[model samples]
Target: MFRAIGNEELGRGTLGHSLHMLLAEDPDFPSSTRSAVDELMRQSELDCAVRAIIIAVTSAQNPHDELEHVLRSHPALLESEWMCDIRATLREFGCFSLY
Candidate 1:
């Protein structure tokens, strides 16, 4: 699941598709998983975070260094349990840290 989420090709849409598949096929998935998916499915909120992160990375002289800053700027993301899922996903993709 984390691997799929971290796939660069999938990007933000990864969580949405993953959630849909899980709900459709694995209705008995853990409560934590369902909660994370529900939060991520708030597309408007997620999009705001994604756009901020993208803009920050684009303008940053060191994009990696701006990751924490970008995330911090998005309060919804910072407060979300889905953020932990994202970090775990990125780590699986060989991204050492989101900070």
Candidate 2:
């Protein structure tokens, strides 16, 4: 069910941290799964950082629109690439929803 995340839960802290720990502490995780889990963790971290900055500046309790606007406004923004990577990795798992 790793591919079943819905809404913004993936980068909202608890879920992401739990997944990272679950994968990291797993003694039997295969190399590919570990790598994918690692990528998910890295991108989740960056996404959380971006979300924090936006919320700090705009004071938006739920800054989904602001985050989307900023990421879509400029292609050069690193958050866009990070978000895309997160989407791609999750998609590879079959049917994950990040939006």
Candidate 3:
């Protein structure tokens, strides 16, 4: 299902959209399945901390809390160069308060 969602030929739109559809329709979906998908998403985002930071900052009402959650969840990213770049970008965008 993750592969299907990631496939460009499916015209399924974004993975998030496909996952939402599956979640809405699949009563038998297990928590483990959701966890696996989440892991895959997290791994995919690992290469782009800026994207993750932007998402964390922009998607939450409380960006500080959201960023803290992200840092806790991905501790390896704590001192990564990408994380530094993300902070600078956020600062330039006037979103450094999120940190």
Candidate 4:
């Protein structure tokens, strides 16, 4: 999930916090503590996506550079489809073109 987030150049922030809060507040939710942790991880991935646009706008780095930095720094990002898409986009944009 971290991989997808990184590849997608997403950020982790308030949205994640909010989701966690909402879930925690729900009295009807049923799951073990371990399951809750897993759900939070999923929420975090989604939050990263939700934050991606903001992150891109706030950072001075180029899009490709931002994504690569995220992927490199977060080893888990290496495993996501987002990573693949990021690579593809970079190639499309000539960020890593060999021309």
Best by lDDT: 3
Looking at model 1, the pairs that clash are none
Per-residue lDDT over 1-99 for candidate 4, one digit per residue giving the tens place of the 0 to 100 score? 222333223224544333433444645322322233244445666345323422331331365765555455454545556457656867587353111
Per-model TM-score on C-alpha atoms: 0.29, 0.28, 0.39, 0.37
lDDT of each: 0.43, 0.41, 0.48, 0.42
As a TM-score, model 2 comes out at 0.28
* Regions of candidate 1 where Cα sits further than 4 Å from its true position: 1-44, 51-64, 89-99
Q: How far is candidate 2 from the true structure (C-alpha RMSD, Å)?
A: 13.7
Could you tell me which 10 consecutive residues in candidate 1 have the lowest summed lDDT?
A: 1-10
Candidate 3, residue 28: how far the Cα is off, in Å = 20
TM-score order of candidates, best first? 3, 4, 1, 2
Question: What's model 2's lDDT at 43?
Answer: 62
Error of 1 at 45 (Å): 3.2
Query: Residue 15 of candidate 1: its Cα lDDT?
Result: 64
Q: Flag clash pairs in model 3.
A: none
- Answer with 3 or 4, whichever has the higher lDDT: 3
